[model samples]
Target: MESEALLSVRDLRIAFAGVEAVRGLSFDVRPREVLALVGESGAGKSLTARALLGMVPEDATTSGTVTLLGDTDLAAQRGLHIALVPQDALSALSPVHPVGDQLAAAVRSVARVSRKEARARAVAALDRVGIPDAARKARAYPHEYSGGMRQRAVIAMATVNEPDVLVADEPTTALDEERRDQVLRVLGEQREALGAALVLVTHDMDVVRDHADRVLVMYAGRLTELGPADAVLGRPRAPYTAGLLASLPEHDAPRRRRLPALPGTPPAPGTLPPGCAFAPRCPLAADLCHREEPEPQEVEGHLVACHHWAELPHPAVDLFQEKQHASS
Candidate 1:
């Protein structure tokens, strides 16, 4: 583990019934930085996020070292040093309890404080997340709050204990564009205020571009690319990363034209193809790609896993656009 890393994950693997979902993953979370994990829906991003807090299902088998501040026992430090902001807000909160009371209970679980002090801290956390009239709103049940309010309340609960690391799994997936921005803003603000590192899991590339300091691109339960967000998103080296970015609807492109899309769906676990899992869909794949999987290697400061990453065109999106045109 690096001395400066707040959290370190080494060769993390999660399997179910002899099938691996997250395969041999490694990364480090620096202090007060935003690390975004992105890929298609079945890329094992959510499972990896849950593994950080030892929150995987009972049936799943996990092996790895998730070390936080030199401690490998993640369960012991769960709520106090690490926390999770799950994808669904309504399901995470209890309907019968007032929002404030739930947050107060969270604070009490991690700290030795009087009921009045815990309540005060709970209201303060709510107010800090931009909840209006927090003292009064705190008394309301989860069912009483609006969609966005419930989301904010969840954020308050996660940060009430001031954990060292926060893991949010698709926190803005269900929101509209306006609401998405608001929720991300609140999350960023809370991250800054708490001075804690954040592990953000989402499928939105725009979110990664705007908010992440570093980006980890996963495919078929393995890392495809990892680097500073600006370098990786701006000039993706891996073919899988390039294909994902090319599929996005460009802001300045003609509105009527069809956007480029990846050719096929992600392979199911335990049914991956020989050699590279992405070889079947990758336009740049060669005979070697089908015969041997490429390991991540440093290329211009980015860790890229592709046999021909060096040969990829500077504007990689052009390659995918040309492929779409040829097929048409």
Candidate 2:
């Protein structure tokens, strides 16, 4: 049976002058689901998320379809029901003004709320995201709060309108571990409270495992793999994905010979590797992988874009024993 997806991004591509940041990427986020667009920085995660919100840079040229509500095109809806928590909270907000007024403005812009009403809603939003003494904090400027508080304030402003989709690009980038967990919990709460789909774009694989219901892995501007979060991370098929999992700093992961890392940097946006974008870095790459770009196709329930996916070996990591070995 088909799932009830809130958005379906089909063949979405983005170009900036001579550079191609996103290349025909496609994915879907079900209503109230947390989908992780997982990748390294400069891997097109934010670009795609911004594309969804119609907030791509002025210098960028875009094509293909980003459909929200399963029918309404993102280009058409633009700002009505989509809100973005950008990568940098400090840069996204105004330093001179109190965070509350900005939150109020966001709410009033989307919904027919008065300034007083919006202020109340803003306080409630701040409170929802675990901001302390939200009413008092509302009067405080963004600079007055610490990095974590400011991040929460950003979340509050974005969700004040009860948007249909929340595009959170590294929402907890500058936060500490405790605050990060709190922010993740607040995202969960916001999802439950508003029944809105959450698209969390983060480079942290740990974050994906902790907060996401599904995962999409991008390599060199193209999606290399996508599946249910647990299944995808637990049993990654693509070599690039396997290497990424191996690179994960897990208490459960063994202290290995050396943590595996993809050798070369991700290709520049304007041009990617000839065949598989990750071929140069993938251990399992064959001659075919170097020449022919693999198309994303379903295998069982997951979608993978590597030709040698099935032939690849499960990475040798004694995870359970590794924890025991660590204690010993």
Candidate 3:
């Protein structure tokens, strides 16, 4: 583990019934840094995030060294030093208990604090997340609040203990554009208040551009690229990263133009081919890409796992448009 890293994951692998969902994933998150884990569904982004907090299901087997806050084994130190704001706030919060009670329980579970103090902290947390009339809202149940409010409550609960690392999995997945940005702003504000490292797991490139200091692109359970967000998004080296960017609908594109999409679906986990998982989809893939899996190699300053990354054209340069023009 790096001494300066607030959380470090090395060779993290997770399997369920002998089917691997995450393979050889690794990264380091420093304090107050925001790292976005970006990938489409079933890319193992969510699974990797859950593995960080020791929340993987009983049927799943996970192996990795997650060092954080002096604990090499993060499983034993979850909730005390690491927290998770899970995707579904409704399911994460209890239906029977008042939001305040549940939050107080979280605080009291780890600290030797009085019930009164815990409740006070809970109310304060809600206020910090921009929940108005927090004292009154804290007395309400999860059902009593709207989607965004409930999400804010979840953020409040996750940060109540002041954990060293906060993992928010798709925190704004269900909201519309305005609401999505609002929830994201709250998440960012809470992280800044606690000065905790944040691992934001999402597929939204816009979210990554706005909030992330660093980005990790995962494809078929393997890391395809990792580097600073600006470079990875602007000048992506990995074909998978390029494909994702090309697939995004350009706001400035001509009216009624078809949005470019990656031609094929991602390979199923545990059933990927012997070579690079993305070889089938990469336009620049050659015989070497299909014969030997490429290990992550340093290109310029970023890490990329592509046999022909240097030869491929930049994603921003008419790659997707050329394809569209050819089809038309």
Give the candidate number with the greatest TM-score. Answer: 1
In candidate 3, how many Å is residue 40 off? 1.2
Clashes of each: 0, 0, 0
Q: State how far residue 123 of model 2 sits from its true place (Å).
A: 2.1
Alpha-carbon deviation at 62 in model 1, angstroms: 1.0
**lDDT value, residue 16 of candidate 1:** 93
Order by TM-score, highest first: 1, 3, 2
- The total number of steric clashes, by the backbone 3 Å criterion, in model 3 comes to 0
Candidate RMSDs in Å, in order, are: 1.0, 4.1, 1.5
> Which residue pairs collide in model 1, if any?
none
Candidate 1 C-alpha lDDT tens digits along 61-154? 9898888888988887888899999899999999989999999999898899999999999999999999999999999999999999999999
lDDT of 1: 0.93
Q: Judging by lDDT, tell me the better candidate of 1 and 3.
A: 1
Between 1 and 2, whose lDDT is larger?
A: 1
- Find the 10 residues in a row with the least total lDDT in model 1: 1-10
Worst 10 residues of 2 by lDDT: 315-324
Residue 192 lDDT (model 1):
96
TM-score of each: 0.98, 0.90, 0.96
Name the regions of candidate 3 deviating beyond 4 angstroms: 1-3, 315-317
